[model samples]
Target: MTMSQQANDTSRNPGWTSTALSQLSSVVRGASPRPAGDPKYFNGDFIPWLTVAALTNIPESKTIVFETAGKLTEAGAQFSRTLTPGTVIIANSGATLGVAKILGIRCCANDGIAALLDLCSDVDARYIVYQINSQTDRLRTVVATGNGQPNLNTGLIGAIEIDLPCKDEQSAIADALTDADALIDSLEQLLAKKRQIKQGAMQELLTGKRRLPGFDGAWSFEELRNLVQTPVTDGPHTTPVFVDSGVPFLSVNNLVGNRIDLTDLRFITREDDQIFAKKCKPQRGDVLLGKAASVGKVAIVEEDFDFNIWSPIALIRAGSSVVSKFLYYQLQSRSVLTQIAVLTNSSSQGNIGMGDIEKLQITVPCVDEQSAIAQVLSDMDADIAAVDDRLTKARAMKQAMAQVLLTGRVRLV
Candidate 1:
């Protein structure tokens, strides 16, 4: 039998029943007290007031919300309804739509949320949250769309139909998914710690504060133009004609921290590329610095692709004195970034001009020292990237597990 048919058959058995949410719980729509910003309506010693932002602190597998950001006055509590612990809450409006959390403490929520109280004895709160989260896209689609803001009322949320299994089966599925969530959470935390270590390394190594072992040369400060073989230049001032595919045309958005991200790249015809190349054609090993909206973001060209850059990107070809990789890190240093910020703030267009970019000061070491420093930083980057890859795979695995367990395709009980 098909999975759906099997689920239906199980529901027909004595212990299981497929039903709408309204049949299992009483849906209570939340409310906001009058004079929302008034001191009289807030900061009371009574109940905790919950906002949609507070739900974010709750873990994915968790069913309880212990604390919230805001508190309500006694008068405010009279206008709002308080939900007991274990009550399921969903953010029903705004960008946080479909986000679900369970109440661990008694609190009153604003109009942006809906609370499900008095859940049936046979139902598990965590399983219900998982089921609702799995169908988040569908719930968002059902919300009214138009000039008015899309929102969900208690009636609409209560009408959602779910395929129910026996209480034992529900608990088993919830446990499996909860374990998977824990693995993902662990990986995410490790990745965050690795990134923090990388930032600290950059702060020390990029500047001359902490010297690499065996390298003890005094660094030299020079204008960015002096460090490059060619004059500091940018791409075409005017927009070029874009085509389906020919040569990749990059902008400030393509520069992602010391690396070029080809994703979401625009294209230009070969003819247009040839014309734009006259202004600033990026060669392999050249450092690209964003001079526009995202000022001072740097990326080293690792590939020798026949590509051109947009006007907002400044291309720098390191001379014999400095290596491209070393210059890229130097540009990202706090000292250089502070200068860029000052220049950017003084400009009317909120961008650093080519003239200002050429005059920006940077410190550089000997070529051999530069290469050694680059290698050390590069190794740290690889470590962080490895952790990030593992985090991605863990999340993907959890998503696949959810699909099977929530659908009853692979029964655990």
Candidate 2:
């Protein structure tokens, strides 16, 4: 059976009832003021203005949305539909179609969104929000308006069916999901805090501003080219034909945040790999920097692999003076990133060249201090990774809970 059909079957519990959404609430398509994007229509502070983009900040299980990106003047508000707090809003057009949020304050929304107001007392708004969000894929498949570009109308949203439990069960399901949301939010906040601490540590430790205890030596400044054993080099200038499975061919997209991600790597023939490796063969200790689209992202090669990089990725192998991990962190420092931004800005295609890479300068300390600083930062990274893993698991569990609890397959009350 299809997902929606399975959902319908699951709702046939002892006390649950299946109902069309129109029976529980009224759906109103939002409007936009004439002369769109005019400064006169906004910022006059008559009512908060909402667009599909602003709904992104609303937490998944949240039921109220107070602030918005723009405010409508009285004239603008006259041309728009004013939705009161507690109204459920859904984006009905464009890429944001099926995205939904609850209005936390009285607001006016643009034409791209629809508001569900005057909800019946039997329905818990949060439960409805979760139900609608979980069925976004199904909703998109059943759109009643537009051809190539899908759009949702009040008729489509209102006619959509939902399985409902009694009021208490609805509240119980919402509370359970809300508790799960709280856990996810807590993990997210903790991750942000850890990242902030790591940034501060990088700012202090990478620079000689905050020296490690028991070590006090003046740091030296050197051009990046002098610190590396090989002359700073990039992969082949021309693109090679991709094969089904052979040696991995990496590009700027493969460099994912401080590491080379081989998950979606394209492969070239071994003969092509041999040709590219002749120029810049990446080893375990070399530092890889993206010079094109994802400019300045640095990753240290952690394992031995017979992989070749694209022309946009520059490879740097540290010499005797600097450690590989230290060089990686140095490239990630704000100072180097700022310089990279300046260099890329000067170029037409927003890419830095090998020449640009060689001209870049970095501050370095003695080998011992470099290792110590890298260790401190690496430990922090490990801690953050652990929390991130937990957050991922929590989100998965919440989704599973929603599928069962919201469907009445597992009764909570």
Candidate 3:
């Protein structure tokens, strides 16, 4: 027997039944007035409104829908479907088809949304939402397409087959997954708070507005060219021939969160590496600032591995006047970033010339104070990274749990 058949085998899995979703809830498509965005049809204060854009905008870890960018007046509500709190909804059309959430407020939904109303009291709305999410890709295959975007209308949605478990089992499964989601949400919130705290620290410490203890040395401003061992330089002007495996080639995308990320790297030949290294070979203690497309982004080369940068990245080797770690953090400061922004030409993709970057001013402090501030910020980054890793694992665990629980492979009761 197939997994689906095994899942619905009442003899083996007691209290589980094979049934279409329409048996448990009334599936109804939302409505929209003709000429969407007409003054008479939209932009009034009746209730929160839902669009596929808003539905998909919600964080994937959240199941409750409470907020939206647009609202509709009573006149508009007459033309749309106003669903009450606790109703399960799915984006039934366009790219967001099959995305699901439970309404947390009474709101009118536009045509792109489908509401699952009058759910049987024994059915757990959250379990249904989780099930829909697990099967989003499969459901998309049933979408009807013609002149416009693909759509899952009421008839198509009501026909979706789902394996149902007993009410108590359903609630247990939903509660377990919801707890997993809450843990992930808390981790995400903590990460954001840590980042904000680091930003505030940077604003004060890097500018000399708040000096570290035992550091009362006067601060001085110096142009970047004066403190660099080499005239600020970039990689080769032309793209090198890529190879299957050689020196890892880096562009602005590789500069992630002040560190070089080699996960999605391209490659160049060893001969080409020698040529590029002469211009912009990255080594430990050097800082990289994004010069094009993603202006002002900065990352420090903290590893001893071999890598080469493209023209979009400018390399700076700090002279004895400044510590490399201090220079890396200083480049991330608002004062320096603002300077880069002002100098960047945004006509095409934004770019700052090497000469322009070299002319920018940097605030200097005693080496000891520079090291102190950098250490504090670096510690905070480590804390945030730790929490981020936990969040990723939490999300993955939730997905795996849903796969088994919603499929009736594991009984929660």
Candidate 4:
């Protein structure tokens, strides 16, 4: 019977066959030039060099990489392994082990990377990459259960088992997944652009450079103390004994983006929460600032929820002079951030004292304009957030699709 007929045989579960990667391609480890950072090897233009970072640092959907940080000289190229365009490479060592990326340019890889070359006609390179990506955990497990240094050498990589289909089906599966990846990449790019636009808008709106219509108020530079209803205070100075469940305890780590993140939240007893609440209770319209460790990070508490923060957080209540949302944005302004950075003491841990936080300068406009400016920026934030949600869902969908498609459980042909 023909190979295609065999692939279509019902007895073989519609042509899906299990085989080792060694049967389909040549798996080889890359090389690194000696005496790291030598100018003779690194500062030349013979070829673009690939490092594990080049693959591991990119976003999940960014499977194709166009460039590298360093280039290799003719001497360096002699020491490194040269990879052509469209070649598939995987990081073979360190924490990023098994991470796969496709080269979009002619380059050479360092010893930390392994390239899959000379793939057979029945296999699609992208299909193999998707398969590798899906089994990243398995690849890491291979290193974890091994004898030598934690590394995924060529032998281990080649010995990996793959569920293979016929050539046509492999290409079809790869094409469908590639299209999904493209959608994800586009969404990621759009989200990045939206963030950049919001940042630019912040630069102009928060400063006096751009003014909203129907407002012609002179902006004034005021100390943070003058604009707050209460003296800035912090959470408990001492860490409390954490309970299995009760009031959520937070720290500088909870300040994610412009909002508080309660994921992996620790808990303190209700008795402890009541005690901390008496000294510093975060209410709606209050601003939370990271005063230690993460130093300039800030977030606004938008809900009237019962959660207590650690000593690393500073609580601020806005007075009638400024809007709370406005204060939140102003604290994140470039000028204010610069001031905070300058005053941050870095003896043991980066700490911005309450006194220093109160004394920092901020540019503020009339209350009416402050509200209007804050509204405009908030709308932009909402837009970016919506796109971000879509991007996240798209990524999850791609993973699900890969699980089914790569396993030949769902046939695209």
State, as a TM-score between 0 and 1, how close model 3 is to the true structure.
0.91
What's the TM for model 1? 0.89
List where candidate 2 sits over 4 angstroms from the true fold.
Answer: 1-12, 37-40, 59-63, 141-145
Whose lDDT is higher: candidate 3's or candidate 4's? 4
Top-TM-score structure, candidate number: 4
Q: Estimate the TM-score of every prediction.
A: 0.89, 0.92, 0.91, 0.93
Residue 205 lDDT in candidate 2: 97
Ordered list by lDDT, greatest first: 4, 2, 3, 1
Tens digits of lDDT, candidate 1, 179-225: 88888778778877887887788888877788988889898889988
lDDT for model 4: 0.87
Angstrom error at residue 290, model 2:
0.9
Candidate 2, lDDT over the whole model: 0.86
Q: Quantify all predictions' global Cα lDDT against the true fold.
A: 0.83, 0.86, 0.86, 0.87
lDDT of 3: 0.86
What ranking emerges by TM-score with the best candidate at the front?
A: 4, 2, 3, 1
**Which residue pairs does candidate 4 place in steric collision?**
none
After aligning candidate 1 to the native by TM-score, how far in Å is the CA of 48 from where it should be? 3.7
How many clashes in each candidate? 1, 1, 0, 0
Show the colliding residue pairs in model 2.
65-104
